[model samples]
Target: MWSGAAHVVDAMEKWPSSQEPTQTAYGLAHGTDLTFFEHLAGNETKAKHFSDSMTFMQSAPELRHDFVHEYDWSRHARGTVVDVGGSKGAIALKLAENYPNMKIIVQDRAEIITHGPRYANTNIEFQAHDLFTPQPVKGADVYFLRWILHDWPAR
Candidate 1:
């Protein structure tokens, strides 16, 4: 996607206002109607890469060092955690590994959820949900929403 930086810059030339347009940089850069997630959901290989990337990124301590060390997740050891818009339960899996007593539910698009492990009868669960719609899971101890603002900044 970085290779199309110049193309996105050229597209910006058409509009130099402070207003937030409906079009995104990725959309303009690739000249496509679908967004990045949409494109990935339609392609199995790309979607796998997106989920794998999320998992691999967690290997970097700097990425979630604060969250793991700063936050006292032990407080919710026996509680439930709903990872809204979680991509293939990467973060959910990590949380479950630390707190085996806690139930971590990972929610995302059906296409993405399919790639996740079955996780049957375990602390880790999977659910297909649209983040834009009303959340089905209620009364959760914690609702984790990491890296969601960039995608749904307004809604």
Candidate 2:
């Protein structure tokens, strides 16, 4: 089925006539007020596919290695880091492996949290959070926004 591909096609076709382009072509095509993640709440299969796709893309060894090595995550050792929209805690687990002392809270939609990953690392945790809402966890040492922000408008 080209259902997913259809969304892409629809986006391209509707881009020119969209009322508020800031909402994005996909948003316009779907005509929904809900943010991309919020819409997933009502569709478990789509939600899983989306979250799993994100996990798969982000789990690439080279990408993880670059992120882990390029930056010095050790500076925030023993501190709390909130991984926003961190589906399945893939990066959080990797970060935990290298920086075991840092407490990591991997947050995503409730749908994602329900199927979050399991790990032996005590420092890493999975949490259900909607980023569109006010952030519940305050004053974290670091707020890691991996593969999440690009989906929204700059404004």
Candidate 3:
């Protein structure tokens, strides 16, 4: 996390007058044309570490509790919950455990999708998807996009 924070700092320092620093900091730190995740996709160890980090963040009890209490799941009884950019389906699994009537779909990049099945059960399903594209699962009762959009700056 510290390294990521450092990267954010570095990116902020390099932020252009009229543009965000994602591409610049990414290129500076990685010396590649690819974005951070794009670079990680080709490396197994880094990819695993990234996924583990996301899982660690999601495993926090208070975070889960806040989400559970804040959202009115009862209103969407027997509905489908699509967890977009869900790293390893951890939150979705938790939701499934609590809301037995609701079905959960965890979607993320292909690199993270492979690890999803390990955490999935009958009530939770995992799909490989890039959130930049149009959502494939139409008419979901809820599309939960937790901590996802900040990765990209508004164009």
Candidate 4:
């Protein structure tokens, strides 16, 4: 697996495949490039792949420090937070640990949350949802959307 990743990295160095392969292929074949969201929207798996990748990416210990100390979570005590597109409830669990009094909703696709732990505690709840539709949970003091914007190009 490591060797395969190295080969991919070497290939990527030669050509930036990681930056929207569909767009690059479209450009090479038709002399026109579509936006990232356009490419993602066309393929249903794009959203799932992107979300899972994000969940895996956040597993690195270094990433924890970046967000943990970056904000003052104490202000949100006794408040409710809804984590949109939250996979595996990692961030929601962290928030629950930080602010025990606050309530949390870990919202993601049913396929992603399938056979996974719903939430870390009683203060948290997991709901399978499609964010493309109207947001189901409301009145949240904070709607956590960590690293979600980069998944889609700005319209």
Task: State which candidate has the highest TM-score.
Answer: 1
lDDT of 1 at 33: 57
Tell me the lDDT of model 3 at 69: 66
lDDT, model 4:
0.66
Q: How accurate locally, in lDDT, is each candidate?
A: 0.77, 0.76, 0.77, 0.66
Clashes of 3: 0
Task: Give the Å shift of residue 100 in candidate 1.
Answer: 1.0
lDDT of 4 by residue, 90-119 (tens): 787777877889888888767666634665
The full ranking of all candidates by lDDT, starting with the best, is 1, 3, 2, 4
Steric clash pairs (candidate 1): none
- Expressed as tens digits, the lDDT of each residue in 24-104 for candidate 3 is 555566666677788778987788888888778776766545677687888766999999998887788778878888988
lDDT accuracy of residue 107 in candidate 3: 93
Q: Write the per-residue lDDT of candidate 2 for residues 10-114, one digit (tens) a residue.
A: 665656544443444345545675655666777798788887877787767665446888788888888999999888887887788888899999988888999
Least lDDT summed over 10 consecutive residues: which range in candidate 3? 16-25
Query: In model 3, which runs have C-alpha deviations exceeding 4 angstroms?
Result: 4-26, 61-65
Error (Å) of candidate 2 at residue 108 is: 0.8
What's the TM-score of each model vs. the native? 0.84, 0.79, 0.83, 0.63
lDDT score at residue 132, model 2, on the 0-100 scale: 85
List the pairs of residues colliding in candidate 3: none
